[model samples]
Target: MKLLIIEDEKDLSDSIRQYLALEQYTCEVAYEFESALDKICLNEYACIILDITLPNGSGLEILKELKRQGKEDGVLIVSARNSPDDKIVGLNLGADDYLSKPFHLPELGARVAAIIRRKSFSGQNQIVIDHLTLDIRDKTLKNNEEAVPLTRKEYELLLYFVSNKNRVVTKEAIVTHLWGDDVDMADNYDFIYSHIKNLRRKLAEAGCPEYIKAVYGMGYKFSIPS
Candidate 1:
C-alpha cells in the first residue's frame, strides 16, 4: 500500500514513515499545505494521513478539495489539536478516522491497514477471489491448496489488479503504485509487461483461470468471466 503523510512536524512524519516502511508500505510525505495538495492532485494513494494544522493553511481545506474532486482515498486525520469541533468537522467532511497527537505508531499502522482493507479488499484480510486466496497479513498467495511462488513485483501487480478488479488500470498507474513517488526514475514500461506476463504464467501453471483482460487501446482489467 502507498501512504501520503501530510504533516508539518518533520520529526513525527519521519517516524511514521520509518515505522510504516518496515511493514511493506510505500510512504510519501508533504510537510506543507501546497505540497500536500499537489501530491493529492498528482497520485492515488491507498490512504492519506492528514494533519488539521498546516503552516500556510488549514488541512480541512485539503479534505474539502478531495471531496470536491470526488477522490475516494481513505483519510486518517492526525493532529495535536483535540477539539471535539475539529473531529466532528473532519468526520462530517469524510475523514475515515482520527487520531490525536502522541499516538502509538503501532495503532496508527493498524488504522491505516484497516482503512486500506475497507477501501481495497472489501474489509477483509484474506481476499478469496474465485480460485485464488491471498492473505494480506501473511502476504501469502495460494491456488486451491497449493502455494504459488511469485516475485515481489508480480505479487504487488496481482494485488493491484484484484483490488481494482473489472476496472481498466493504465500502465502508468501501475508503475506509480508499485514504485511509489519516484516513478519518473523508472526507465520504461517493459518491467510492467514482464511482471504481468510472469504473474499470468504462474497462475496458469497453478490451474487458476485467466482473470486479467487487455483493453485493446486502453489498459488492463481483472475480472472473472461472466
Candidate 2:
C-alpha cells in the first residue's frame, strides 16, 4: 500500500517512512501545505497520516478538500492536538482515525492498517478473490491451499492489482505506486515489465488462472477469467 505523510517535521516524517517501509508500504511525504495539496490531487494513497498543524495550512483544510473532491482515501490524523474537539472535527470531516502525537510507531502503524482495512477492504485482514487468498497482515498469498512464495515487490504489486482489480492501471501509475519519488531515477519501465512477468509466472505455477491482462497501449488490468 501507498501512504502520504503530510508533516512539517522532517525527523518524524523520516521515522514514519522508515517504519512503514518495513511493513512493505510505499511512503511519500509532503513537508508543507501546497505540496501536500498537489500530491493529494494528483495521486491516491491507501492512507494519509496528516498533522493538524502544517507549515502554511491546517490539515483540517486538507480533510475538507478530500471530502469536497469525494476522494475515498483513508485518513488518520496524527497531531499533538488531543482535544476532543479536534478529534470530533476531524472525524466529522471524514478522517478514518486519529492518533495523538508522541505515540508509539507500532500503534500508529496498527491504526493506519485498521483505517486501510476499513476503507479499502471492508475491514478484512484476508482478502479472498476466486482461488487466491491474500493475507494482508502477514503479506502472504495462497493459491487454494498452497502457499505462493513472493518477493516483497511482487506481493505489493499483486496487492495493488487486487485493490484496483478490473481497472486499467497505466505503467506510469504502477511505477509511481511502487517506487514513489525514487521513480525519477529510472530511465524506463522495463523493471515494471519484469515484475509483472514474474508475478504472472509465479501465479501460474501456483495453479492460478491468468488474472493480469495486457491492454496493449493502454496499460494492464487484473480481472478474473469468466
Candidate 2 collision pairs: none
**Error of model 2, residue 134, in angstroms:** 0.9
lDDT of each: 0.89, 0.93
Regions of model 2 farther than 4 Å from truth: none
Query: How well is each residue in 1-226 modelled by candidate 2, as lDDT tens digits?
Result: 8899999999999999999999889999999999999999999999999999999899999999999999999999999997999999999999999899899999999999999888878899999878889999999999887899999999999999988888999999998988887989999999999999999999989777889999999999999655
Per-model TM values vs. the true structure: 0.94, 0.97
Tell me, by TM-score, which candidate is best: 2
Report how far off residue 141 is in candidate 2 (Å).
0.9
TM-score of decoy 2: 0.97
